[model samples]
Target: MGTAMTNPAVAALIARSHRLGADPRTTNYAGGNTSAKGAGTDPVTGEPVELLWVKGSGGDLGTLTENGLAVLRLDRLRALPGVYPGVEREDEMVAAFDYCLHGRGGAAPSIDTAMHGLVDVPHVDHLHPDAGIAIATAADGPALTEEIFGDRVLWVDWRRPGFQLGLDIAAVQRANPQAIGVILGGHGITAWGATSDECEANSQEIIGIAARYIADKGKEAPFGPRIIKNLDKTVRRTKAADLFPIIRGLASTDRPQVGHFTDDDVVLDFVGSERLKELAALGTSCPDHFLRTKVKPLVLDTAPDAPLDEVTTRLKELHEAYRADYRAYYDRHATPDSPAIRGADPAIVLVPGIGMFSFGANKQTARVAGEFYVNAINVMRGAEAISRYAPIDEAEKFRIEYWSLEEAKLQRMPKPKPLSTRVAFVTGGGSGIGRAIALRLAAEGACVVVADRDAATAETVAREIGGTDAAISVTADVTDAAAVEAAVNEAVLAFGGVDLIVNNAGLSISKPLLETTEQDWDLQHDVMAKGSFLVAKAAARILIAQGMGGDIVYISSKNSLFAGPDNVAYGAAKADQAHQVRLLAAELGAFGVRVNGINPDGVVRGSGIFAGGWGAQRAAVYGVPEERLGEFYAQRTLLKREVLPEHVANAVFVLTAGDLSHTTGLHIPVDAGVAAAFLR
Candidate 1:
């Protein structure tokens, strides 16, 4: 089900690849045909001329064709880039490009043909649209793009798409062999010469870059201690669920897709609108995201204890205001020929006590909204990381929001890539929980890098999965910074890159709070909290360097939330780990990385991390059982099953995959729903 594109799909893909390009969001008129021509004899047919695809006129790319394509010999076009620099005017380069297209008998070649030709890729297409211009016009656009793509992408200054642009791109490509695409400031992007599928993949990757930039720019500047207050759990869950459908609609394009849902009062209350707009005004993650999430968040001030009747009435009022703002926005910017706004819709909805709600037509769209909300929270968190986040100018926000080219770019997108080549690094990988996650990601075809403190343990598990297409194992002490860094480096070296990191190596210690010595705290922190952060930081830097984004998993415990006797150090450290993941999620998200935590309850197996004497103390304190520990733990859970390491690993796998791209900055409890029934 998760296989790469097949031959038929590949042929049809290349022949009809022109359908893959999106126009620059700023360009109001003109489309360009752009693609790569292979020069060396084709390995498949030994023919030289190979026109991958053309950005055809008169149709949405979603339904493109090979008939629309015009193949060209690569050798002829390759000579053009070298000659362009000697030419004096744009006309000369345009004429040269046209000559190549006419010689091949295709539609006039893309205006960017010279640039595309010089790159020597397998597929390519180019577009001119408005959304791109909106971003190009931003002050921070170039810096933001660089942050997202790292050194793998090239940025070209805004120039007409003939000789000048081609020359600029050629020089950059010559210098950076790993560069993938070129972003033209105040213009559209150019992703050339890959499979038609790869062309589309490049576009999505660009979108991700833009999304992260916008998210980073818009977050609030943080200040002071975070004062947390408890609230009614039932109301928060109900509201988050009620809002989930709309949130799905507003962000992700499909419903009942991508990810499953869970809501928590603690999470919601922490994010609710006591000062949400004051926060959102800080700006969006970046300007481009405004095309979907808008520039500002709608806020609700209702208290958690408010009556349902009052909250419902207030929500409707907020919804109406949002609709009114939409009409005003469209009216102010709509061109005479543009479509009219006839519906009452809210891009974002806020319900007091339930955090924020987003609306979408389907699950995919809702996921986008969820991503926006998550980023908004991150902005708030990051503001604390740096200075307070401040809102961008309204004109700048409008530039992105109202750009038809940008809106059109969102018209069609490539299907979500199956999580085929992703990799996950799980510490303590040989047996127990780490083994479970290693197996899960391996099953998904992700190279599973299993590292453990024990060399043989890691090797044994690595050997077991050696039969898989992507799986590896290594030995290291998670607490040892050098070892953790080496493990991450080895994974990156072995696998091209790492997309998922699960910090699951930890031990538990239980004793009376008074009996817990400073050494106990330091030891627990070293292996658990400090190790998780070290591993996460190492992987974070690598993912940041890749500029492709990644996922990080921290294996914490339920004790982080519910306190008893003994686990003072372990519980505190686990709690710190959870909080650290949240901070890391905010900081690294701009690079497309998502950080999350998994809190498992009573997952006793192999090495007994949870079998500390503190359990006896808790049992004595709560007057439960020492022998029925599993049942005693399960009694509080709705599912009434002793939590297992496998359960936590499975959750990590899902979150690390394509299924939960919209989720980050929160903790998912794999404790059979005990946390769900906590207040009850």
Candidate 2:
């Protein structure tokens, strides 16, 4: 990227694509494709040949790089129409593209390849801008296109993307030499140019014209006033948190899913509108929208102010009906060759006066699906303003949804990590073993909630894991019951619900039997024992409500078993925590929540407890130098090697990541063989 790119034509193409993609009005993420055709020397023949570089399948235009481009011989690609067996068998052309490749062909070509190669222009940009789609999906789209652009921009009826659609667009372009672009009915927009600059400009111009036309000609109050005005922000968020776990449970009936929640005013407006039910039932207008969001959302039927009991009951009934409807839809269109129905659960759910919730295999996919639906909402608003909103036929949607090529893409996804679709909530995650545990869980593909008293450090660790979609930070003093409950609510609000709860917050104070004060005893027990109980108790509600089964882990210490001098309070507190593992495991088994504990001795390198004066106190007690205490502790162990945070993190992974799914109420020692503290 930084001086790595060599080809000027490809460079211009990428730059233009980024410009178009950077604006949300231009395209949604991973929705559009761009291409550049230029001269390249044939390797064996050493003759100048025409080469086409197009955005590869499943790649986003804004983030696209040269490696994301599929290069093919223009002559061979343009020749495909001759051999094309028409629309029914146009899918076979995707396989034939490999033969047209120049060298290895940077990335796999998408079905839209023909749309780029067959065009006579040097550059082509196909986008799904909201305003353009509004015009494309309007009932009077063809007539509106004729009236607004006056023939410079033409119209094409709804056609599923394939080699046939590509040929069709090319035919329209050739028929009207004066036309700059064409509005794809019920899809998006495609603009071509003599050069890369012209192509990008034309794409922007088309989008601008459509936007201006909609704004000037659009009718007011198209959604027919707000049916339920937004609830107060604080109240709305609380309601969202309450509903999220329930919705997540219903959504995951088919497969375990991660969820995302949004309460932006734009989303609030749409959900609260009088037309919400009618428009949502018609489904999203754009192909990309429904592809991620499913054909339509499961909209809550009651007013947002409905009592919680009433709303939850209604939601469950709606979910059941929705799944039944979805299965019937699948049965209606599926043939022998159709890709198997992935899931009957709705990906998007709408609650009036509250917010929208979306679900997917991971956080980013769920979040993006929400964003695409927001785009669809905007499209619907504009279309209804100018004319009635009209999407493609449902049969056509089923064709694209169950297409074998789409299935191949699904099959091509790399195997998920062991912890994929799991969300972990780690207290004391800003530092020490908790930080290490959070990092490990994220690396293994779990969304993380890094909760700590230190706001800055918690956010830093969360940022390290990756931003909003992967991990989020919540600041809370674990000892406070209210704070613990609120933090769990934050996790529910952020990632729908928690799958793993790690009670790792603690502080150590060393004192002999007679010198230990009541304050020290209460502080240690309150933090390590009661704090763990509060966190587990609060998160267990969401886990139980989700009905998805989860894990609760305690980072207890080897001192819980070993009698250590000058550590009466800390040791007793950890011992209390250790027993809680078995107790909770027994009580929670019926709910499918596994409880486990990891006991590690003297994890000195990155120990928050050791760093906070415990090292020097223990050193003084053992008659060793403060700096040498770690070595002293290691020498006394059977393995004679110091245990570390990473070692404890590995133990956490093993206990929860499927291998030990059947093992619970277990305390696995990670003390490098401390015989005295070994589990019996």
Candidate 3:
């Protein structure tokens, strides 16, 4: 038979890791690691030698590939236990691992590499499966595991991941030679076998054992009625949609944190239970969750129906108290031997009847935390059903949360994009200039809301962008006050709050002064003037409540500054809207909301107004073919370059990204240097 070092063996191992990691029930995002022992030719010397290909730190196993695995000399890694006579320092041990790399590329191997190496097997799978965690965190976890798996499994106490953890696992393996797996109390599970298939099978078998055990215990009855009563009361008195903005604003930092509000029936039921405080105070279900969610979630005192200003004040006070409590936890846990750890505040916030909110540096991180918490709720519920939920004690949580090894993993993470955690609202986002802006903002890592008058078109744009976690579609008529209000509320519900608002919904009209009807004038002003006001007013309320200073940009036109012949109604409305931008900026400057405008001339292509027959009529009046109309405007500018929709979007990005943070109430011409439209 071919040895485990064969190419097929390695390929099978990689495939198994991807499959296990892809399921959140098996592994949370980037939370698990896998390894396989094999022999391969050294890239430098071309000599056949034993090696360990392990999942690298910070690589998501769900989408892991060959490059995501780091290759290290097996003999060198196994020798690590002998090289250090006593407990090894984290930094020195990491340096030694770095020295043993067989190749120069790929990320550093997972911090748990030594643990995987100590196992006496060809294949190893380490996972934080929800079912396994549910069983492992129970008060009688070890007893339950023994009852379910007999001699097949061993239990290891919680130890910070490093040299010590490997030593503990090795000790367990020494006593139980027949053991196929080991459960790390308050941590996760590890399974090993001689082949990739065996390793995967062992994991599934162990998980099934625990899952059935929990299922047979039956459900906890008290949790349901209490939760339903609280949730119903909260919903009756207060709307989650109304308080989301306030919570988002108070939770934000200078880096612009985002909130993901989820009231999924399961989550609401969990948060509404009478034992929420007790369950939350029990600590995280697993050690891996500590890094992403902190020690425990912050439970807010405000309810859904509370007054807006009153709730905002309460949140600020609660957040300050939460920070103080974290500092206290750090001080009590720090010792002469403790690693230098930064104070990490709560990443999840519980809002009673409203459900829970997860905060992160970016949308993906927030969503990842949200997923972990949801799993945690299930695990806690299961543990409560069978017995008391007993997670690692506070000191153990501190050791893992502040472990130098875990801190090193964070240092290796990539830097985020400029607009990483900000949220943007784009009106008329289904197409044209609005569509371009939405795409650009999303690319910069901001969660975007595509708001348009057409519901289907907005949904198409949102699908093209992605889902609710990344983007959502809201149908809104900017000219209608109630619709505009609903749009802002929807955005808040979808992404917690709004950081940027792009007012780009407008129509155009061209006619001689004598031929211009009152109806035509009203139509132009209603969309250009009234629409901009309604959208801005709705967004400003949330921004001011948040106290985080936001951005608003109106897509104006050159007709505002330089009126052309036979365009009375269009020019008048555009000019009025531009002046309104200045007044709004002056008033909102106190609240840190900057209002700006961009004026683009003759953007014929990809424009809804131009495509709706206006371009052809305008071209005929100018005695130019419709195809050449873009060039006609291009030649009129000093730079003589066509002003594409992208150009206007770029300017919008500049204003919203704080490039011109100090300058507001200004209109920058994106018309390739239209001299007549120059502000100066």
Model 3 weakest 10-residue run by lDDT: 228-237
- The count of residue-pair clashes in candidate 2 stands at 0
The better-scoring model by lDDT among 1 and 2 is 2
Per-model lDDT: 0.59, 0.91, 0.81
- For 1-680, candidate 2 gives per-residue lDDT tens digits of 12225778989988987887788999999989999998888878989889889999989988998889999999999888889997878899999999999986378999899899888889999999999999999999999999999989999998888888999999999999998999999999999999898888899999999999889989987888987978898889898988899899999999999999988887888899989999999998677888899999999978777887898899999999999999999999999878788999999999989999999999999999899989989999999999999898788889888889989998999999999999999999999999999999999999999999999999999999998999999999989999988999999988889999999999998889899999999999999999999998998889888989999999999989999899999999999999999999999999999999999998888988889998888999999999899899999999899988999999999998999889889998999899999778
Q: Arrange candidates, best TM-score first.
A: 2, 3, 1
Largest TM-score belongs to which candidate? 2
> Which residue pairs in candidate 3 have backbone atoms (N, alpha carbon, C) closer than 3 angstroms, thus clashing?
238-305
Residue-level lDDT tens digits of model 3 in 1-680: 12333577568877998889878778888888888888777666868888888888888888887778877888888888777656646546767888778766766777788877777688888899877887788888888788878989988776667767876886787788799888888778988888999999998888888888778874755254564345463453236666766666656753467777677777778777778888887768587786778888888766556676787778778888888888888899998877664644468888777788887787677777887888888778877777778888888788777777767667767887767778899998988888888988887777999999989988888888887778999999888999998889888867778989998988877778998999999998888899999999999988987778888888989989996877888889889889989999999999998999999997898887888777886897788999999999899899899988888889888887756779889898899988878886
Between 1 and 3, whose TM-score is larger? Answer: 3
| Ranking of candidates on lDDT, top first | 2, 3, 1
TM-score of 2: 0.98
- Candidate 1 residue lDDT tens string, 276-318: 5555554453442454456565665566566655755665566
lDDT agreement of model 3 with the native: 0.81
Candidate 3 C-alpha error for residue 569, in Å: 2.2
lDDT of 1 at 502: 85
Clashes of each: 62, 0, 1
Top-lDDT candidate index: 2
